[model samples]
Target: MKAGLFIPCYVDQFYPQVAIATLQLLEKLGVEVVYPPNQTCCGQPMANSGFQHLTKGCDELFVKNFANLDYIICPSGSCTLHIKEHLHHDRHEATATAIRSNIYELTEFMTDILKVEKLDASFPHKVSMHQSCHGQRGLKISQMSELVAEPFSKPGKLLQMVKGIELVELSRPDECCGFGGSFCVFEEAVSAKMGKDRVADHINHGAEFITSADMSCLMHMEGILKRQKSKVQVKHIAEILNASL
Candidate 1:
């Protein structure tokens, strides 16, 4: 299938490796992936901060870059959710709608659309899974702990397919890492505390690394883990899925 890769602004700038891993993973699965050289932000930061009405430029650019692709797959759940929910251009509502319908976060695209049951990757480490709020709750890639329903995770399922990887359990599974974009800046103390607690949970449970689909959340927790000089490292799920060892 023809797919366009939507790398979020932060991932493009800070976590380029995650984007690379995502690209490699898709190619390994035999997808014809395309990268729009002029693609920019999904206008999520502005929209989340209560300025969605001003995201017309971003929306238009997104529609222009991705309207023709069979699928627009992104590694970021937060950005994908933003486009799916807030992307709109008054002059081209149909284009906006088409974009939204075709866009999907990486894990969802792999599990739901690709229906991948196995992977040729290996990681011999004990790891914990961090379900980013946008991917887990918004995209419903997995069942939330609060819901009275069956438990399943696309990311977790994919991880299980990899060789020599042990998935650890967290005390409060599916809890937010408190990286709500600007929420971290506005509520510094609370955000830091939440990150610290989340990191501690993974560390206490013997996790060598914490993995999640959202690099934003891992970036937030990485800051806290670094400040504490913790041995635990944060990794994006794409990196693990695409790993050769």
Candidate 2:
């Protein structure tokens, strides 16, 4: 099936590889993906900073670019969640609603719409998965720790299918990486401490790499890892899922 690809602005600027990997992985899985060049940020930065009123143009442009697609897929959960929860264009309300309802995070699309049971991929490394708040709590990509329900993880499930990849267990698996967009900019010290704690979980558990569906979270921990000058690296789950190494 055909789907419109929504690569987050940050991903396009700082992490194009993740966007490329997502495109490749989807194509590999028999999806016909189209990237709309006019697409921009889902106005998440403005909305998160309490200037949501400034996103009128952003909302209008987003709906214009993606309204025709049957499904919209994005690599970043934070952006996808933003659009899913806040997309509004007063003149195009119906189209905005459809875009919101049809948009899916990359992993959410894989495990739910694609219903992938296996993959022709390999990643022989000790990797730990970071359950990003947007993907987990917002999108319901995994079971909440507070809930006494049967635990499940769409990302973890996909990782398990990769050959030679060892999905490590974290001491506190679902902790936030403290990259609440502008929160990191405003609450510097607290955000750094929280990120350090989250990164430490993966390091102490001997994780060779940290993987998450949300690059914003990984980017936060990546900064912490760099400050510590450790050899650990952060990768979007798309990179891992699309890997042959």
- Candidate 2 stretches with Cα past 4 Å from truth are none
Best by lDDT: 2
- Assess candidate 2 and give its TM-score to the true structure: 0.99
Candidate lDDT scores, in order, read 0.93, 0.94
RMSD of each: 0.8, 0.8
Clashing residue pairs, backbone N/CA/C < 3 A, model 1 = 122-245
lDDT of 2 by residue, 66-131 (tens): 988889999988899999999998898999999999999999999999999989899999999999
Q: TM-score per candidate, in order?
A: 0.98, 0.99
Expressed as tens digits, the lDDT of each residue in 10-41 for candidate 1 is 99999999999999999999999999999999
Looking at candidate 1, what is the lDDT of residue 144? 89
